[model samples]
Target: MEQILDLETDRENQTAGPSGRMHLGGNDLTVDAGRVVLDGTVVGYLYENGFLRSAREQTEDDEDPDTGQWRLVDDLEGCDFQGTTQDGLPLSLPGPSSPGPTGSLSYNGRDYQVMQGRISNAQHKILGEYYGGGRFVLRDARTNTERRSLDEGSVINFSFAGTASDGRDLSEQYTRPLYRDQISYHENEIIRYFQDFDRLDQQQRDYVIESMRIWAASGILQIVRKKEGNAALGNVKHGAAGVTRVRTGMVDLDAEEFERDIDLCARFGPLAVITTRVPSYVEVRVNLVVSHEFGHQLQFCLSQAAQDRIDELYQARLARSIAKFPPPSAYDGGSELVHADQVMHREFISGYAKASVFEYWAESVAAFSFKESRKLLRQLDPGIFSILEQVVFTPEKVMSAVLCEQILNLQASLRFGGEFGKNLLD
Candidate 1:
C-alpha cells in the first residue's frame, strides 16, 4: 500500500501521538510516553524500541548505548532531536521532551523511525520529571538512525581561498567584479528572496544572509555584461546558461547575454532562449539560469549519501554517453548534443544536459525548483522526477534537510534569526 502522510493537521493538537491509532507494515502501534513540548510549539514522541532504536542500547558517559560507537551524549536540555538514517531517510523523536530509556515518535497514525528516548535532561514545562539519555544531534528530518557518521564536517561557509574554517575565525570575502549596477541588482535580488523574512525564524534568516555572505565572501558571483552591439552574442567559457566549480563555487552569469536571450525569447520564442531540450511552455530561460547556478551551490551542502546518489546516477548517464559518443569518431560533432545517441537526448531535460553529469544535475534541479517549469519536467521525465522526490529532496538527508529547515525556520527566525534553498557528477 502506498502510504500518504497527512500534511495538514491541527497545529495545536497536531503534535498528538498514538492517541489516534494507526498501522505500519501491518503492525499495531501504541503510545507509551505522552506528548511533551519543545520550543516554538513543536511536540515530540517517547516510545520504546518499537520503530526507532533498540531497547538493548547503552546510556552511560557519552556512549549511545544503542550504537556504542560515538560518545552517547546526555545533554537533552531544551534541544530538538533532529536526525536521519544513514541512507538519508528522516526520523523524529519526541520532544523538546527529555530522554528516556526507550522512545520513538508516533505521528499521523504512523510510527516515524526514531531513537527511543531516555530522560537524562532536567524537566519539561508541564511534565516535570527527570528524562533520560537523548543526546543533542543535528538530524535529517525524514529518515532516522541511532547515530550519524562524522565524515563530512558540519555545513558551514566554505572559504573562497579553498580552506574550511569554523564560523568564528574566517575572514570575510566579497562578491567579485560586481559593478555598482550589478551589485545593486544582486542585493535587490537577495532582498527579494528576503521579503518573506517575517515568515522565517532567526536561524533561517541568519542562514540566508550568511549564505549570501559566504557566496559573496567566496569571491564568487563574478558578473559581466555583454554590450548591446557586441557581435559575440552567445559566448560562454562553460557551455550552459552559467558556470560554477564543484568546490570553488565561482559563478559567471552573462547578464547582457541573458538579457539579450530574454529579448530573443520574447521576439522569437522562449525556445530560442533556453539551451535544454525542455520545451518553452513558460518563462524557463532567465529564472532557470539563476536557479540552475543555485543548484550547483546546493550540491556542496548535501550529505554523503545524497551526493553519492547524485554521482551514481550521473555516472550511469555518463557511461552511456562515453559509449555513444566514441572519442574522435564519426559522431564527433560541433554542438554539445549532436554527437549524443538518441537515448541521451531523450532522457535529459535539455541538450545542455548531455555535456556532463554536472550539467544534467544542474538542469534538473533548476527545473524542479522553478515551479512553472516543474509541471512540464515531470510530464516529460517522470523517472527523473521520482529520483529527485525519493532521494535528493527527501527530508531525511540531514544536511540537505538543514537547508530546508533553515529556509522554513526563517519564519521562526524572523520573529526570532532567517533563510535559504542541488547537484553532481560521477
Candidate 2:
C-alpha cells in the first residue's frame, strides 16, 4: 500500500535521548543533534526510544513536493537497524540480549520471523539468514537449498507469504477479472455460459486466477473459459483471424479421467502439472493449461525482436537434439519424427516441450510461474530463463512500446468486429 508520511512534522516533535550520547563498541557516539553518524557520515536521524529515519538526498529530478528533501525511508514504528554483537553475529535490533524465539521483523508491510538467527516464514521454514559484515544467504524454502548469497542492501525477489506488496490478498484481487478493457470480442459469450470464471468450482477458480496473474503484464487480450469434454484438456487459438481464446476441459471429468489426465500431464506437461509426489486436480488442469495458453498469447503479441530471440533459442535446442540423434531422412515427417527428437533432448522440462519451439516457449512460461518449477527451469534451461527475464518476467520492462501498440491495435480492431466490417461499411 502507498503511505505518505510528513517528515517535517515528525522532525519538529523529535526528542533527544536522556544523556544525548550512546556507546557502540569503543566509539562514544553523540546524538545531541539527533543525527546518526558512522565513520563521520550522517546516515540517518535518531528519534526518542531508538526510532531511526534513513538519510536520503533529494535530487533536482525529484519533483514530488510532498516528499521534499528528507523522506521517511521506512515506517518509524518498524525496526530499521540491524546491529551486530561483539561476537559478530547479526541482530535485528541493538540490545544486550538476542531476540526471543518469537522475534519478528517487518519490512515492506510484511512480517517475517527470526528463527534461530535466520529469516523464516510462518511455517518456520528458513527463507534467508544473516551473517557478519552485512552478508545474507537466501535459500529456496521448499528444498532448503541455497539459491544465492547477497549483500545487506541488495534486493531479492521472493514470493513472500500473505498479502501482496499492495496490502491486498492477491487471490481476492484476482477473483474478479482484471484488464477487462483489453477483452474486445466475445465478451458476452465469455460471461454467459460455462466459460464464465464464476462458474468454476472454488478450487478450479483459484488455480485459473493464479495462472492469469502470472501473465497480467503481457498485454495479450484473451477469453479464458472452463469447458467439459474428453477430447482435450485445454487449448489456445491465436491465429490471424478471430479472437484469441483459452479453454480448460476439467469441469466435468470423472475421478478416473481426472487421475489419468494428471498422470499424462506429469509425463508430458509443465513442472507445475505435478509439482509434488501427488498432484492436485486444480494444479494439473487449471494452473498448467491456463498458463500454457497465455504463453501462446504472449508469443503472438510480443515484438518481432523478442519473437526472433525465442525462435533462435528454439532452433538451438532443436539443433542440439538433432546432433545427438541424426534424423532417419531429410524428408522425415509426422509425429514419429517429433517423438524421436523430443526423446533425444534430455534437458527438456517435459515431453511436450520438445514438440515444437512454440510448445517449448509455452511450457517454460508455465513452469517459471511456480517456485519449484522455476528453479528446475532455471537449472535445465538458463537460455530461456534469460530471454524471459529480459522481456516478460522483469516488472519494469515487461513489454516494449511496439508490443504495447500492437496490443492496442488488436484491441481496437477486435472491438470494430474485424477487418471485413470496415470494407462492408464502405
Best by lDDT: 2
Q: Model 1, range 85-143, lDDT digits (tens) per residue?
A: 22333324343333433333221111222223321211111111112211223322222
Overall lDDT per candidate, in order of appearance: 0.34, 0.41
Alpha-carbon TM-score of each model against the true structure? 0.37, 0.39
By summed lDDT, which 10 consecutive residues of candidate 2 come out lowest? Answer: 417-426
> Which segments of candidate 1 are over 4 A away from where they belong?
1-189, 192-246, 264-287, 318-345, 382-426
For each candidate, C-alpha RMSD in Å? 16.6, 18.8
